[model samples]
Target chain A: MVKAIDIPFGPQHPALEEPINFTFEVEEERVVDVKIRLGYIHRGIEKLAENRTYHQNVYLVERICGICSFAHTTCYTQAVEELLGVDIPERAKYIRTIFCEMERIQNHYLWLGFTAKAMGFETLFMYTWRDREAMLEVLEMISGKRVNYGMNTIGGVRRDITGKMVERMEERLNYLEERANYYKKVCTKERSILKRTVGVGMLEPSDALNLCAVGPTLRASGIPQDVRADEPYAAYGEIPFRVVTYDGCDVASRILVRIDEIIESVKMIRRALDGMPQGPIRVKVPKNVPKGEAVSLVEAPRGEDLHYLRSDGSDRPARLKVRAPTLANLPSLRKMLKGVNIADIPIVIAGIDPCLACMERVILVDTKSKKGQAWSGEELWRYANEWYRES
Target chain B: MAALNLNRIRRRLKGRVQEVFVQRERRIFIRVAEEDLRETVKTLIRLDGFNHLATITGVDIGPAIELIYHIIYKDAVVSLKVQVPKESPVLPTITDLIPGAVFYEREIQDLLGVKFEGNSSSSLFILPDGWPDGVHPLRKEWTLGRISKKVRRLW
Candidate 1:
């Protein structure tokens, strides 16, 4: 008896911070399949990035996602710099690293806030954002702006963090650590938190890698592959840190993975500040680049980010390819959704922290009945679902 | 320094490897002619551990269009670029071998106007409504009237 029940949710859901819609095909309250369609906020950022010069594209890419804006710009700039063969300064590396960690602090807390909101715990969501403000204030002190830092360039950073600023950051980190530890306990160990997350959306490691998964989603599945540690870029190879991984492969596992990384991020900032080498913040970058290709990978708050750049001495890139973590991890939705309760879909999807600007998909499924459709390797094989080939 | 799992397949019966690049610190790039792209993709993706299609990059050279299919397995990244004339850009889709390439292939088509043979939908992505026919913004010839002139403003 194969009964098909369908349900459509989103483009406007409390669980999603961006505009995204997903359909779940449920079999008696348990989701057997899902069709995720999210093209609601397709802003054409990639085409825009191509139109701008190498230097200007940094600012444009930063605006891709407000949560992890710095990481996007840094990855873009680093790739361009490599293509141009320009080396950044030592102090600038440390400063950039510090800012990246600051972005991480904000992104993780924002996820926690969204997680709280998804579970109907508005008070916890309010508290998480309240604590998040401290991180934002510190970021403003360093960058002189809140959202788009405008700190990164092709060769180096725009400014430096004075010793006084470092001391202030130290104080802020102390307070934040105390509050973050408390929130971790309340959110991960509390009775209600565990009931909502534990054992929900469990995924195995082999299944995750098969789906080309990344970020906390892959980490939660016990794969010790943090782009920072495995293929270190910037000052990550020089710094000391651990890749946080959990073997549980469930929603709870994702929460614990990000929470511990938040704690480690604090340590990275402190190390960068204390051991920062003195040097110029900016390097002189030539307008024309040599003809060559370079690839760069970095660990964003979500997962691994890949950039491929080739230059032909032109103002713009001859060949540019960017692989955001959100896109890489989308394939794992099927693995995570199988056998899970229909009500728990939001939590499982949120575990990956997807950035929708890079992902534009269609959301068309039965809006009610909550039944998921079976999507095998065949559905994906239909090919180029987005572009037309005129025969 | 680390190990990778890859199932390497040579070019099609009529195709040959145009370029083979082994990167120093990051990944590998495989360059094949346009005709053999289908065979190259099918063989590499079925490798015991190389089931994932990392990404697809489009390079506009003004005179000709280039498509680079990036494949990742374990820790190694390999790319295969197929160069096509700008006049009529079209290539077969590899979504059959690795389903993950669907979005990436779509993105290349949307940006470069290179059609993926046997794709599901044929539409523009990120192109403004009522755009001109046969105009791909990423192509080098799609000159920016005033946008390119802003090069001096960054200084």
Candidate 2:
């Protein structure tokens, strides 16, 4: 007889970077059902955005997720700029495109490292992160910051990619391309990696659509949809690149999709560098934005990052709504988690690159007692650890 | 083809909605009657190929709570807005059609006090546990001062 047991994975688990509590119902080695509890990191960024000026919210949104900080700022700034009806300069558009692709390189490397680390391939994790540092160095050279570039402003990019900076970025890109190719080979041919990820977490293309999966997660499931390709923004319309898709529709496919995307991002960045125009990077705009609602969508590393800003002819946004890719991809996570081994839970969750920081929001009330139970960080960690050992 | 798709969608829900128009480039806005919302959404998803429900954003617009369901179709985004009186904010859930909307609907229910009629899972997905009941933070009346005051009193 199979004895079913309830296992709480985390409010604070060793696997999760952010606090996402998952209570897994397991029978022997297979997961029967999974209940996810979020909100541990809910800072109410959307509500907070309503209180800050449009200019101030760029920095605020940039902090929503560390790995995709540049994506958030770009989306927010683009929405505000749309509201202002100011045309961004050609040079600025190319500069924004460069930063966006550079961000993709850094974010994909970070996810690759984290996923490898989750799967206990510590060597691969270290190597990927080491190469990731080279990408960050290039970002820091251009944006003056390693993490949140602060490159985006209302009208255009804040800084120009000087010729010297372009040369440095090119040097880094060549190194990154070589490393990416090596990683791709290891991902495709490595026996241990193939055994773990090949047929695991299989998601059909139709399932991906029903669950509204975005970015690489959706693309891996035999869908060629990408925001940059579908809806061209910045310099994407002018630049040349192909949307990468795989028919494998499994964890291995997801890994391969991102690896190929890194190659494509390198090509796009090189295109932006070669054809970059010369002009002022920014245009002066008024403090108060016109009364309108603007929707901006950018293909972030994980998925499509969307921002909806409603301005009431004031400096501050009347209402700001952020729909991060992770939120859209959570249902897909739940779908993938079902029937997987308890140990594979970490890689499956990390595969989605779940950014709970960006997905977190506000309000809770327990229906049974009319009062919710708040678990301390230490208590939740203990609960997660105890379940892992027992199950 | 994109224009025809939008036109077909607009045609299907033209009479059921209060107003509908292209808000901007690649954005179509439709303000629907509260009763006709679920039907309109079903038509869009089932018939119009608007498979992706990008997100459901709830805003406190003074008198009424406005819930906008941003649906993705190819390159365009169709935002279906439905307004409910703040006194009794309730709307039918679309989770049955688009499973991805469960989280967004729950978020609206938690933060804005807009009750999703058929959304089964009520355990708070967004806010931390022990938050005060009947006090929706996203409501306009629940200003920063009032919210802090309410939290202080609740504890």
Candidate 3:
């Protein structure tokens, strides 16, 4: 028998800028069961691909998200290029790699700032943004815009990073490294910061793997998976970097993992500069691509971003499907969120460093109790702390 | 990456486990050999460090519905596509094995009307109240109406 115990968390809440409604049944503020409902931002991007010309779809895919605009273009462009079987020029590869790293740095900085702001650490957020501005400036210099660089095209990238620009980026990144180190300490040593994050939201390695978590979220769970190091593309194969991993497998570990990755990306950019191959930035693509499917991926700041295209020997693709990392990662939240209080939901969710969208709501109900209310952050903390203390 | 021979990964896993293809030096496919998928996945996951299964891709591939696992062990990607016949498209869910594929499986089931065996529930992911039945817009057979049927975007 279903008694009335329905609770709505949000399609809009302070913890989220985007809308998602997670309604969970409370058993003394501990979420025993959860159901997630999300479709609020599904703009039918995949269907939108069916009508657009293959060349035009690159632009369409990039608009899927502002923060990850380049990721979309890169993955889409790579898929098309693969189908056409064209070799991207060495210099174009270098340039794409450079900008790709720039995107990673900027994204990590933004996520760092967001994580800080989510935790009420306004100063840390401000500091992170202050440091991030320099990277965005460099991105604007290369692509003529702060976000959505607009340089990706089928076969090759459209822009090149000049030596002078590389020097400029290096100078800024050096300073960013310094500031990132400072923030690293704040994230690790600060009681409030550590208290809110450290062990609060945890994903055991098994659950992380079971959920097929990606990017920093997976790496934080002691999984050393980084696409750049794994399936090197866009000059990634030519570059050198470590696959950053954290054994903590908690929100704090994720923070550390992202920080470590930003540092690595900075190094990758420098390596791209040191060994950038000079050549044409664009290459000829097939007027009519062969009827076949292609799948391509890139190490986006979030995680593995995938693009699949099935061309029909026409200018337009017969089918295109994009698998954003968050799609695989959402279920992993259950492993972290449950058995904890509600207040920690926002920041802990933030800790996954989620792409601005892809929030799902889980609904839970207790058969025995008719009363219902969703978990708040404070309640979440009390429950988590109580469990930890009691144990 | 050094260890990943995308060609070998593609060859080894092809037919035995799923639909396999190599594109621009990368290998990907869907897991069809349900019984061998875990072992195949374990090998890929161990070899190339394709440590993550990014997401699942589902398409209404005409006669049979397709579900692609899209695994990333290291940099090498091994996609597992399980084709289910339209009359009764049912593939065992790997969520218990790769928990990350849960939501993706859910999304695939919701949009394409393919049933994933072993999922605990199916309360509808993208559909809404009073949504008409047998009208999955993503199906190759279904075309988008001049005005889509009150489609609400999911965040």
- Residue-wise C-alpha lDDT for candidate 2, range A1-391, written one tens digit per residue: 6899999888886366688888899999999888877788878788788887677687789889877988898898888888888889999999988888989999889889988988889999999999999999998887777887778888888887777887888889999999999999999999988888987877888889998999999999988888898789999999989999998988888899999989999999998889988888888888799999988899999999999889999888999999899988888988998999988888888888888774322234588889866767567557645753453
Each predicted complex: what DockQ?
0.23, 0.65, 0.58
Off by over 4 Å in 2: A358-391, B47-49, B153-155
- The whole-model C-alpha lDDT of candidate 2 against the native structure comes to 0.85
lDDT of 1 at A102: 87
What is the per-candidate TM-score for chain B?
A: 0.78, 0.89, 0.75
lDDT of each: 0.75, 0.85, 0.75
| B1-155 per-residue lDDT for model 2 (tens digits) | 35435568767777886877786778888898889888988888865446588898888888899888888877578888899998888888888888888888888888898888899455787777788787788887888888889788767
Model 3 lDDT tens row, A235-332:
88788789988898778998999898888888888888899867788886765789888778887888888888888898888889987776667788
TM-score of each: 0.82, 0.92, 0.84
Ranking by TM-score: 2, 3, 1
C-alpha RMSD in Å of predicted model 3 compared with the true structure: 13.3
iRMS, candidate 1, in Å: value is 3.3
lDDT digits (tens) for residues B27-47 of candidate 1: 777777788788777766655
lDDT of 3 at A228: 78
